[model samples]
Target: MASQTDDTDRITVRLAGREHRDWTTYRIDSHLITPADAWQVTLGIPADALPDTVKPWAAVDVCLGQDVVLTGRIDRIEREVAKGTNALAISGRDGAAVMVDCSAPIFTRRKATLTEVVDLAVRPLGVSQVRVEATGAKEKVEIEPGMTAWDALAQACEANGCWAWFEPDGTLVVGGPDYTAAPVATLVMRQSGQGNNVLSLAVTEDVSGRYSEVTVLGQAHGTETTDGQHNIKHQETDADVPGYRPLILVAGDCDGAAEAKRRAQKTLMDSRLEGFTITARVRGHRVSESGKPWTPGQRIQVVSEPHGLDATYFLMARTFLGGRDKGSITELTLKEDGVWLPELAKISGGKGKGKAASAGKVVELS
Candidate 1:
């Protein structure tokens, strides 16, 4: 029940983080200011009048002698409350209101802990791990196990006596820290091979858009030789032409080729493509009396080209038993051309006796 006045008087209030600070006579009166109005006045004080540790949006404890009175965050200056009067609102911890007269009381501001600030700002968005860091403030925080980085940060902020605000767009507004301190995105990739020499790759995205995090999950291409005598070469092509898109690749053997193909196709369809492609390759050998048949290792490659295009190609070798000598290579390429026919024809023409490759439209994979 503090009032407004023109004469300087000492007043105190409890801040959000349970820290207490003293204010000297700058102005005091019998008029009650809304929470919003109190915030405005607090911001109007001269920078030199407040402590050096005081910062914008800080949760300060106000007091009248030894007794704490109110708690709220410091907002900007309130310009036009009334004639010859300067006022600002303080948003209380429990959503209450406490107004202050800027011209009378000499107020003191103090710093709050980092934990306090994060607790007020962070909210769960279905993410698994969350990490929060302060850009400038110093504090040690212990994050609980199995908690997302966001939640851990909130707990830390609360413990440190800081104020955190959640923006309508989902970004966090923290006291004494910048937005860059928040974690952006996390990416997870899992790969497994089946009996049919087919490999499966799974990528998961777990983060909100407010963090401005971009993730690209794709396969890495490399050649490995076993026993030094077997030479395996595999090719991967995309049916669609060039464009910018994120791609993921999987290669290995599977029990059911159809099921593996279905899963891969579904992943491609479900993924958001800015222009990307995925390719897989499979190789196996057939032994004969003339010589040991060559079995090439499976390969999957995802390539992101310069012009914002993504392409993927898969190659599978067909083996012939009993010296029938029918070994052929099949190539499937996904390209991003306006017309698919030209690229398909080019891939088909590249076939040879040592290798037989085929190219088809993206629709074929669908």
Candidate 2:
């Protein structure tokens, strides 16, 4: 058993039927707003700490006291030989990572509901259970030729405004954010170095993800006659954004009018709120208002005086780092509304980019 305290949570590592307790360092990275609820863990120890009979692909389990927090197979092992003693490092992600490497069957012209398509794609992978929330319940989906399982799942998630991720126990869950739910708790962060719950704080905004207008174009089947004139037809939709910079988006090759319109509306609606992130670190393992240890994907209210920001935000991602030297700290990456949508830029490149040069241009993924 591992030790547990009010301000600290102990983690136990088990690999290939052996328990590892002398780890020199460890870190857990969990993405709460991603399609896979992806989590990556790394553990390091002296080389001699390894059991005599150890090999790659061994079953690895991470636990907090008696509760299993993560279960997956180890995919990487590294060794370092220094002047004195060597060190070993191991890392891997959860089961959902496997789906990224696997492929799904291609359906040339099959029509099925969104739920049915998701079931057919993931069922073969031994995904214990699949639950798609309200938004995608009655939607019809088509599986095109040569679509990977991951693509199929992403398609459904994108259209329905939902995210897909596996539970720690390997259950596949697909759902939208519960905006109506109550927040976990109010975390008061003061700028003063003393008597502040937050050790550090950062706020950022990106204009690339914001758009002032969205234009969608879809393919129209067959020709139509208007006033005795034969004409090729097409579907189009447009959305005007308010307050955001005048960036225009042009999306083409949509399946149909409805699909084109939905895509345009969703892309604009989800992007209305600019990308604003608040990153902070808090000491100890904070228990949320929900009575559980703080984790990502939960809503929380934050009061930061120096920043003049007081609002409810979604805990999008978190990293837990703890050791004998630094005790424990929970690092949080938050989104204003906790919406699981894509961002314009993965990172803020340097500060030298000319603002005038980037104005009124659609930001495309490279």
Candidate 3:
């Protein structure tokens, strides 16, 4: 009893050097971000239906139509037997798991750019494919001891104000969220059996962590002869919010006032972006505007009067579920427009290796 869309949707399972076709698939949850980009498949089978050839650690490939949505290895399998019925569950992670699990040691003489650091970190792992965005400018950076490739990648991304994730085809993509595109669809809550196609929606707004003023204190270097002291310069920035909610940051590596100001401004922008979020559950698989499946980093228009919210947001995370009863549902978590940090320099401060406490400033140098 498969619907037209269901007939078109397919999942291909490969195990023990063999392909299992026409297997019943229950649910699929996948994302474009690390750790969250995983999938699960459930099949109705009789007791002892699983053959010995089907084992964990087997390679898996999931497809929607002709497009390969996930390329990974099977992590685990669960079997249930009850009420004269039985079922088998299989789950696995995307290719990024290799990067997340591999251990790597990277070093640079004096300094290197964010792009260079990232290239060095991943070169050791030998990922087959990548789509790294152009990250202009070099910055002084350090990789802490005993850091995994995943940790190093995260640090590089945070410093460059960009994000990285694995594509369904196992290509690692590093870039910033883009908002110039128009929204894919507009969601409006309506009465039962009305015009609304949404299943569930929730909006959140928090001002507790917001700050109206941000101050970044940087390194104090050689001072003027008049005072015969170290030169110390600080920078302050303002947020758009009302009242005075102040945040202070210390940049041990910050070279001067200009660098300090950049850090303060970036911090304020990050805090403001994280101040609010929207979570929604929608029916169907494709967006009305694009006629394509929902994907992370896409723009969408959301309207809900009860929550007093009417705004456009960027999809930060999503989970797609499809099965016999509910058909298909897409759960989404969105962030406001200003939250993307494409070209901005990031702030990093902490104890690092080699250099004296002072050599490594409180703020990272760009």
TM-score against native, each model = 0.17, 0.76, 0.77
- What is the Å distance of residue 98 in model 3 from its true position? 2.2
Among these predictions, the greatest lDDT belongs to 3
lDDT of 1 by residue, 230-343 (tens): 222222223433344434334332213332443344334323122333332222121222222221111122332212212223222212111113222222222222112121
Give the local distance difference test score of model 1.
Answer: 0.28
TM-score of predicted structure 3:
0.77
- Put down candidate 2 lDDT per residue, 1-366, tens digits, no spaces: 123333226666666566654345667667754534333334455555567545665666765555556666666777877787476767766666666667766556576666876768778766667776545356555667677777777776666555677656656777755544566777777656555667788877665676655655545444355222122223222233336354334443344556655566566646643455778887765554444666666766667777676666667777767754556687888775523443221222211122112211223321
Q: Of the candidates numbered 2 and 3, which has the greater TM-score value?
A: 3
lDDT of every predicted structure (CA atoms): 0.28, 0.58, 0.63
User: Model 1 off-target regions past 4 Å?
Assistant: 1-9, 13-50, 77-366
Summarize candidate 3's per-residue lDDT along 208-233 as a digit string, tens digits.
87777777766744445432223444
Q: Write the candidate numbers in order of decreasing TM-score.
A: 3, 2, 1
